[model samples]
Target: MGQTIIEKILSSHSGQEARAGDIVVAELDYVMGQDGTAPLAIRAFADLGGKDVFDRERVAFVIDHSAPSPNEGVSALHKLMREFSREKGFKLYDIGEGVCHQLLPESGEVGPGSLVIGADSHTCTYGALNAFSTGVGSTDLAGGLISGKMWFKVPGTIKFVCNGVLPPGVYSKDLILYLIGRVTADGATYMAVEFTGEAIGALSQEARFTISNMAIEMGAKAGLMEADDKTFAWLRRFTSRKFTPVTADPDAVYTRVLECDAAKLEPQVARPHRVDNVVPVSGAAGKPVQQAVIGTCTNGRLEDLRIAAGILGGRKIHRDVRLIVAPSSRRVFLDAMAEGIIQTLVEAGAVMVTPGCGPCVGTHNGVPSDGETVISTANRNFKGRMGNSNAEIYLASPATVAASAVTGKITDPREFI
Candidate 1:
């Protein structure tokens, strides 16, 4: 009845009255960076003759992407980032800690009622925990690195209400992909995204993370769901930090609203190059797939692995397709191993890699051939995004990726399930 999650986070950072479309300067509660983009900001920081970052401890640098670089140039770039972090008093998250967004929440740096800015696009992933987070460019990051405060034109929010339940083999990725067809890529540009409805309340933290993580593809500043009991219960195991929950005001004005009674959804896919290039599952069926890779900050949870494993338990990967999988974090990886998921996947002809954002970022591992096509569980199918610019990439849910791995072609997940 008061304000939405985005509004509450902004209010905590703003002392005076705040309203949508107002250009307000708010001090960032957390500043995040990863290997690929951190060095750029560092270079700009030096060019500005900055002595030390504003509130060094609040700035976080992560070495998750291309950690052990796939090439020499990438390795050198990572070295520069390491040097920058060592010189600055920032909290540099080194290799093995995990992806930037995951480590942010895992370290308790992302709390409720805080505004966070990250150099990486998927920074909105933190919104699952009720923080207002968004991505920024290196230039803006440099400004924030020098001054703790940054400018944001408060964005109007579009509410997405989901009711009913998801069928087996379906996930948040499917829902978002389907919605992209409705809203397109630029639909939410400069607009905050607030997700509601019973399905959202019932989602696991991992599942919710999947939704908020991909919100960036919709050009969304942030995506938030009500932090109800499930979120609180999950946080209890991770931190002792206490904070107030923020939700949308009953009468909050939304520039637009989307409603989906999720029970009607089937496995959905976004065909190559653009997140908004969405179509029904049947549209992509029977198309030959040369590779099937799973794992990313989104849909890299243990539950995602379990679903793929159940489907691939006794089957071998398609003769023409390669199957690879990566866990989201060390914790998720450990849990999967303890439950024999690793063995099941390996036995079923899948390659299990370390926990990191590899294929998703298109830097390390899982490089496909020039003309090959792949069915990926990671977000984004941007042309040349996965290596060879000419290679085709199709984006889909884990179930679809798994089914394709077994059949060597894009098949509706419903058939396999």
Candidate 2:
């Protein structure tokens, strides 16, 4: 009769006992929408005759997907979002502010035990903070904006207990990719994946973000972790918000439990057109690459930049490879500059773009050419994901992408490490 983390959080918000498959109307702590979807939500809100948002403080809009106005049509949408935010007093994150997922956590808007809804599928990224966050459509976002509450069918939890220390050159990204490959893309549809065990605990908060951000690829409703000292430490640097971390009871029922060992795991790569078509680095080595990207919502943090810089230091990227670095946030950009990480990457032949979802969503920047092969630290490898259906994308960890950039092929990071 024990409740899982999602069940417990829903129970608190709904003021009733919650269980798997139970529909409950729960209060939301925060809600967000980004450029790709917010415009629709804004229009939908008007369609619903929405005059004032339930709370300005709890709602946020970010312009990151097609930042700096990729085209006139997008520019007009940006204007609409700006005009609305200005009139309604909701927070608007302009160009260079960062992706919604990164900005919310950095500004302390997200915390443990909070129920959050975002209009972006990758909104599950906040689950690293021990919160239950999920994505919704534009219409649903409009509803939450007006009422500050949403109904949910509590999802069953799937516990993934990772064990052992991650081997050299292998990281949290590799572990998650390996899992997704085994479980397939649609394996965990509508389920909450609770990550636990020794290897997961050994990961940094940034690494955990990379893991949780990709949970949607596996069809997970949310990817969650238990808050510990590392989570609290990261929160302290951002906000003074008081949060009581939520954890599943010892006897909480799980739909399934998977045990994984990362002791001998090598770097993983999800091949083109499908995130589940993954293989070890050795299987895809020497595949020519025209471009390599080191930043996105999944791997654009400071730690990822430093790892790329460390690998590229004292060397230049291959003549055939174009490496792009997109910082996730302005804060991360400024901090990296102060530490000379930016300079090192630029000097090593990496091109730096604005801090946003550059090249990931294929809205504008860093789009690959026809027949081009790109190795990126992005979450998905679906065809046309980077603006061209002809170009192929291979997903890997930051280290793997950096090393591959140096050699102009799919190379393992362990060689440089």
* TM-scores, one per candidate: 0.96, 0.99
RMSD of each: 1.6, 0.7
- The alpha-carbon root-mean-square deviation between model 1 and the true structure, to one decimal in Å, is 1.6
Alpha carbon lDDT of each predicted model: 0.83, 0.94
lDDT of 2 by residue, 346-400 (tens): 9999998889998998987788999999999999999999999999999999999
Off by over 4 Å in 1: none
Model 2 score (lDDT): 0.94
> Which sections of candidate 2 miss by over 4 Å?
none
Judged by lDDT, which candidate is best?
2
Please give the TM-score that candidate 1 achieves against the real structure: 0.96
Report the poorest 10 consecutive residues by lDDT, candidate 2.
Answer: 358-367
Q: Pick the candidate with the highest TM-score.
A: 2
| Worst 10-residue lDDT window, candidate 1 | 1-10
